[model samples]
Target chain A: MEKVLQINNLSKNYGNIRAIEDVSFEVKKGEVYGLLGPNGSGKTTTLAVIMGILNANGGSYEWFEQPFSKLSRRRIGALIETPNFYPYLTLWENLKIVAKIKDADEKDINNALGIANLLKRKHTNFGHLSLGMKQRMSLASVLIGNPEVLVLDEPTNGLDPEGFAEVRNIILSQADAGKTIIIASHILDEVEKVCSHVAILKSGDLIANGRVGELLSAEETVYIQTQKPEDLIKSLKESDLAKEVYSSDDDVAVVLNTDLNSGDLNKFCFEKGFTLTKIQVRKQSLEDQFLQLVK
Target chain B: MKKLFNLEKIKALSYPPFKTLMIIHFLLFFLVILVVSRIHFSIPGFSVKGLYQFPNIWEFFPWVASWFNIFLTIVLITLVGNEFSFKTFRQNVIDGLDRNDLIKGKLILIFTIAVYTFIMVLIAVLIFGLIFGISLLF
Candidate 1:
């Protein structure tokens, strides 16, 4: 896939505080990329630098291989922080203003409202809407005009479960339609659920980044159920795939790297006259990997 | 710039309170003229010497418009402050608006306030001119 966004050696400082230090990463087109980090980990700062909201102390970035420009921004839509709208404006009216600002055709307003599920609430003032509704309305601003890229900061903020599901569905649909997404969120589960790729940030540094599956697969373990659990454990102890092997009840669990072969272990057990009942492969969750990396 | 202007105009019109207030102001200003004009015609031989004769009151339209502009300008300043006073500005950049677009968005907001107020003043001036013109012929 083509690289849609690239950041090289990006760094930013707020007074004496280093917000981001030597961060580099790439987000390919048609993928949901997550910027995962804790608060004060510089997630917001890095985004600000990319969006050109703050001048970076060092490094550079480009979108779609083109140097960042005003025109390029029009192709990107974003929701950062709380959605800003005139409080007295109805949901439809707020979106209409955003549509105009985005240079989208007037007819597209209804479509944007529809996608946000705010079509029925078109005449309700923005201030009076619930928090979740307000968030949807804000997202509607980004979803309008069919921008090529959607950069969302904590997209699910203030959303109830149903609203969150709606936002996730919209994001999935957008990804399916081949639009690029760059999402920054402190919520690990949300990132794990939506991102195809992820970049883990720590104290202004890019700690770990890769395909979500790859990152999550970093810590792999396998469980083997055998009749000769004792002998199976002894033989597996000598193998290099076994980082740590221990037997629990009828199953021998081995925490190992990705290269470990189940066939070799099965053969060894069979040769030793031990009946292997089952072999189960276990992959680490994104949250586990994230916590490990951050640690 | 024109695109920005239109965007600002639409945003300004979107706010119900702002829109409602403008409409209310228009009607009230109209009624003031209507009542005065009716009273002038109702009483036979009533000397209306100081009604429209106060030259200072003619300046009231511009004065009020200027004050409204100042009030909105204060609100604009607050709006600009709010951008930095909160996380939204930073979040916007992370979301890919870039610095140029951020500036453009803010500029559009200011222009909207300016233009919206300008139009309101223009309408008031036109109405006042009409009333004064009609009164002179009577």
Candidate 2:
């Protein structure tokens, strides 16, 4: 994978408050990277800095291993926080302005509106559209120019279930097309569902950064109940497959190794003559991971 | 330059406020010309007349036009302020417009208004000078 973006030792301050400090990360091509954090954790600020909307106080960032330049910007598209179209203009007219700014062909407007499912509403004024439509319009604007990379900040913010699904689908479709994507989202579930890699931030600090599978796989938690819980716990403790095994009142739980599955646990226990009564496997949700990481 | 101007024109064409401001500017232009050209229409309360006097017409037009500058200023502020208030200024940057693009867009708008006003004022002077200026040359 080629490095598409490298943000090194980035820091930003707002008159005294540290928005983000020493934030460093690399995004590779064709990777759906998520900058996951709660509100005020500097997700918007970081994206703003990367997009050159806000200047960073310290450190450096490069797109495609090259310094930031106007030509590089033309290769990228962004949908930051909110939809900011001209209220009095029709969606078509608003898109034309965006196309002009992006230096995209006017014909691309049709494709973008089509992707947003807003072809019929092209003539409708932006103010007249619903919030969901407004979001889709912004997404459509981002799609203009066939940009190679997309930076979306809180793509699902202030959206209903339907709107959320609509935006998510559009993002997924874009990702499927092999576009490098960097999404800033406070919602762990959204990041989990869409991102292949994630970087967790808390109080503007990077806590964890890795592949989504390794960062969040609830399969690590396994619950086992047997007629002979004591023997099973002791046996699993002796086995390398089980990292942390403990027995409670009625059941025993263990944090299994990533490579080891529940089937391996059952086989190991059965070979040791421990009859299993109940075995349930559960992976860790990003919410649980986030809580533990932040703590 | 032409491409950038076309972009500005596209935005102005769609924006309702831009059209409204233009209409108001034209209306005021004609209104000022009509009122300042009437030499003997001085009412009992007002005494100043023959405002478009020749050789001083350049100075006269701006004095009459200066009265409408406040309105034009308001229009300009609203036009520029709307970009920020609507957050489109940020959008432009996000859409691959360099930050410099913003300054250029504004300069274009300012000059566009200036050029439009100057042309209107020039036409007003020519008509007024021919009809009223020579006879009441100052």
**Model number with the top DockQ:** 2
Clashing pairs in 1: A51-B98, A52-B99
Tell me how each candidate scores on DockQ against the true complex.
Answer: 0.25, 0.65
Per-residue CA lDDT of model 2 for A1-295, tens digit only, reads 7899999989999999999999999999999999998889989999999998999999999999899888899989898898888898899889988888777899999999999999999999999999999989988998899998999998888899989999999999999999999999988878989999999888888888989998766436778888878777777787788767776448787778768888888898888888888888767678867775676
Model 1 lDDT per residue over B62-97, tens place = 555554454565555665565566444554454334
Chain A of candidate 1 compared with the true chain A, TM-score: 0.82
Off by over 4 Å in 2: A223-254, A257-280, B39-50, B133-138
For model 1, how does the per-residue alpha-carbon lDDT over A1-295 read when each residue is reduced to its tens digit?
7888999999999999999999999988888999999888988788767776778999999988989876777788887656766665577766666665566776777887888888898888877988888788877788778888988888888678898888888888888888999999888888988999889999999998888887766667567897677777888788665776776457787767456566666666677687778888777677756765687
TM-score of 1: 0.72
Best by TM-score: 2
Location of the lowest summed lDDT over 10 successive residues in candidate 2 chain A:
A214-223
Candidate 1, residue A13: the lDDT equals 93
Q: What share of the true interface contacts does each candidate keep?
A: 0.39, 0.80
Candidate 1's displacement at residue A183, Å, is: 1.6
What value of lDDT does candidate 2 attain over all alpha carbons?
Answer: 0.85
